[model samples]
Target: MGLLSKSRKASGDVIYNNEVKPQLVAKDGNIHIVMINSFSKLVNQNFGVESKYTEQIGSVINDLQQDGYEIVDIKFDSLKGQGITGTAEGFHTLIMYK
Candidate 1:
């Protein structure tokens, strides 16, 4: 890879290590974790539940699966002003267990 591209990849790695990876870790009991991912766009005039879900959280979920983590359940919510996404509309909660 070019020097600039390598630097960009390194920075992205740092970001994933610092941010995205932590969101998938267990909050308690070392068994399961609950993660919230937000979407700002809609698909096919609907929540685009599974597709959007797979698009946003797919890779991380795949990694977890390789490490023996399995998805227990997934839930969705449509809110206008709540949680970390004050005005965000589409959101999904992923529940995973090892």
Candidate 2:
């Protein structure tokens, strides 16, 4: 079984526990591009210092850059929650290439 399959069978969470953190998944050290998409819910829960979604994304990007990763692209999407039952949310996507 592949890493993804093993991860899925182990837990439902894909990004958090399944995928390797702090390292790019490369095949023979040939992976030159990496993409990261983070939701407000996950980011806020993970990073205790950041109180806002943008702040969380910024913190992550800063860390990655400091670690010698180059930012290739970035995108942000704002989500307006529905009715009174939904909470506002946002998505931050970062593309890094080494």
Candidate 3:
């Protein structure tokens, strides 16, 4: 079975692009591009020192750029929840796409 199949069987929530909706469109050079419509739900959550996390994500993107990876976009998601949600809930997710 493929990794996606296994993940689905395990009831895992997968993150595929920012948009949940899936669509395809032809781009220049006849290249097909898949688009996922999604909003930054993480931004809705409360995170102490939000700017700090944003800066951290920016730094990461900068590093990646320096490494020669063309950053298409950077999405910062503020993990929500409290002590029960784990420390990760307080962290931000830096989604980088080349």
Candidate 4:
């Protein structure tokens, strides 16, 4: 088996706990964190349940702020239709530090 045989993709919480937390503990300076999520995959889906990417992102921001991180910037953008034939896709990004 490989070193990652039992490992999986880390969730936001995992990243915060294992990576961010350690850095914060070892350093007294500000720590920068950037998170990005795309909604294009769900844009034209027929799933009955509403997607909560936006809400989840907000929750992460709130949690980070509560943990002492300051919001540095926020950006939202959409990819315009390609060649005037493709549908536009949206994305959200957040930059925080400390």
Candidate 5:
């Protein structure tokens, strides 16, 4: 008879406890953070619910920079459908020490 053997292993999905929570760190001895979200969504939230969301997104970005949040980077996802060619799906941003 063959000898019996036992083995153990561990595996599971990693649950994110801090998802979407703003992280602030000391970079170069200054406060730093990064934000990621849909720009169009934000504008829609801040401005109106039924208006054209894309143009408002641009306005919101400009306004944010004007308020001095160190808009370091801006990127956009692809657009879809018609009457919304310049529309961006979302964006990622890196805010430097401020």
Candidate 6:
């Protein structure tokens, strides 16, 4: 065990990280898409000005930064229906990493 080993995340952290982070990789390189919506909810939905996943998104960003990913830019979009699912209460966050 070394300095890096000491920084290793606990199993809970791993599980949470996996849940918050999308399985898709960056369209080009280190960029990633983060979806914050009711479908990702642990129980219910968040319809306030702030998102329920805001804090979780921050954690994911921190973890990505620790992995040598520099956040280049972030863009957000209000996501709507995909196919015929109808409107959704979620946001699409595009994160570019260097």
Off by over 4 Å in 2: 1-20, 26-51, 82-85
lDDT of each residue in 1-98, candidate 5, tens digit only: 11211110000001111332234343344555545343333223343442333333344444445545454555544333223444434444433434
Candidate 3 lDDT at 86 equals 40
Candidate achieving higher TM-score, 4 or 5: 4
- For model 3, how does the per-residue alpha-carbon lDDT over 34-64 read when each residue is reduced to its tens digit? 2222222234447465443334344444544
Tell me the TM-score of model 4: 0.45
Q: Write the per-residue lDDT of candidate 6 for residues 1-98, one digit (tens) a residue.
A: 45433333332246336664455354366555544333223333455534334544555667767766677877777654532345443556666665
Which scores greater on lDDT, model 1 or model 4?
1
* RMSD of each predicted structure: 7.0, 10.2, 11.3, 8.5, 17.3, 9.1
Q: What is the lDDT of residue 3 in candidate 6?
A: 47
- For residues 1-98, could you state the per-residue lDDT of candidate 1 as single tens digits? 46744554454355445665676665444666666655543323454444433444554555556655666765566555544535545565555565
How high is the CA lDDT of each candidate model?
0.53, 0.46, 0.38, 0.52, 0.35, 0.51
Compared with the true structure, the alpha-carbon lDDT of candidate 6 equals 0.51
Residue 7 error for model 4, in Å? 24
Instruction: Give the winner by TM-score.
Output: 1
Evaluation by lDDT, superior candidate among 2 and 6: 6
Clashing pairs in 4: none
How far is 96's C-alpha from truth in model 4 (Å)? Answer: 2.7
Q: Write the per-residue lDDT of candidate 2 for residues 1-98, one digit (tens) a residue.
A: 56744443333233423342445543343425444544344323343543344444455555556656666666555554522445534453544445
Answer with 1 or 6, whichever has the higher TM-score.
1
Itemize residue pairs with steric clashes in candidate 6: none
Q: What is the full ranking by lDDT, best candidate first?
A: 1, 4, 6, 2, 3, 5
TM-score of each: 0.49, 0.45, 0.36, 0.45, 0.29, 0.47
Model 5 residue runs over 4 Å out of place are 1-54, 79-98
Candidate 2 TM-score, C-alpha based: 0.45
